[model samples]
Target: MSWTVDEVMTRQVVTVRPATPYKELVALMSRHAIGALPVVDLVDSDGRLVGMVSGTDLLAKERAAAGARRASRARAEQAKAHAETAGELMTSPVVTARAGDALARAARIMHRARVRHLPVVDATGRLVGILSRGDLLKPYLRSDESIRHEVATEVLGRLMDLPPDAVEVSVDEGLVTLRGELETSSAGDVAVRLASAVEGVVGVRNRLGYRLDASDPRMPPLPGARGLPAAEWGR
Candidate 1:
């Protein structure tokens, strides 16, 4: 089972309104020990998310006040430097993640948006929670036994449709080792790939043996050989 953002996100989020003063924003972040704050519009009953303000955003004011001038500063940065309120300092068009979104998908969104924090929103675009880079690392804290169970029961048994004893899964410090005998090399490869994708799995060691080399076109398909075609295996 894949994890969702809501599962790992901090449900109790610290947010600020657009009208929140810069001093208040700084105080709030300091009190919460958070790097950023989601800016919401309280006028709407739902308090819909409007933007985001981070420590970097607050630093802009200090940089300008200190007379730090750089030609490389973008126009948006220049504007934020003189901004006094969250409405003016915040980065509009905030990047967000849905509660039900997959953690991997949310991570990709953060990467593409170049953001470290994401405000988790509901279908109505109301802020429900907040996700940070640290939250994504929570899965890696799963017990080794838990990781092994998932690989055996979820990956090999259900996903690969293999019997309970068909594959032997072992884990140590998040590294997974698979020992099994399958009908074809494609099946072994699929097993390895699926096991590697399991949460908390650091790596997969493929010790699986196959009766047929179906993946190699040069090898003739043996009589009574039953395995996924090479082209189909790519899926």
Candidate 2:
């Protein structure tokens, strides 16, 4: 089964108003044990995410207050140093994730944006939840039996239309080993790839044998041609 942000994200999120005081923001973050807070604006009873206030943003003020006159500091840092409220110190045009976003996609967004936290929004852009790097790791906690079941039932039985005995799925500590014979090399390759894509799968060991090498152009096509196109198989 595919996991989405809504499944793993924290539904109850602690947010700060744009006018929230800087000291109060720190207190809230400390109490909640969170490194960042979503700066929001209440519009028509909806908490619209406006920006983000992170530990790095708060540190800028501390560094400036300490009289560190480093010329390398950006003008933006200098400005944040003098700010006294969340709106003045927050980073705007924030990167966000949708509630329906896939967990893998949300992980990519977090990695590319270099942020640990993501504010989840609804279709209308209202804050609904929050995701963190810790939440992305929840999938890894799935039992080995569950991963094996999905690889067997979902990937082999349903997607590939393979019979119950067509593929022998074994899982140990999230590692899947597929051992069986298929009609063609393309089918075997697709099976391996699909098994690897299953949630909670650490890796896939492809021990599947095939009757025909569809990838070999010289080989004659099978009667029904269950193999995928060359271009698709290559992928």
| Whole-structure CA lDDT of model 2 | 0.88
Model 2 misplacement above 4 A = 1-3, 69-73, 103-105, 139-141, 163-170, 177-190, 203-235
The superposed Cα distance between candidate 1 and the true structure at residue 131, in angstroms, equals 2.3
List the candidates' TM-scores in order: 0.74, 0.73
For each candidate, what is the lDDT?
Answer: 0.87, 0.88
lDDT (tens digit, per residue) of candidate 1 on 81-192: 7798999999889889999999999999999988899999998889999999999998988889999999999888887788999889999999999897888776787788
lDDT of 2 by residue, 16-39 (tens): 989999999999999999989999
Clashes of each: 0, 0
Model 2, residue 206: distance off in Å is: 6.8
What is the Cα-based lDDT of residue 214 in candidate 2? 67
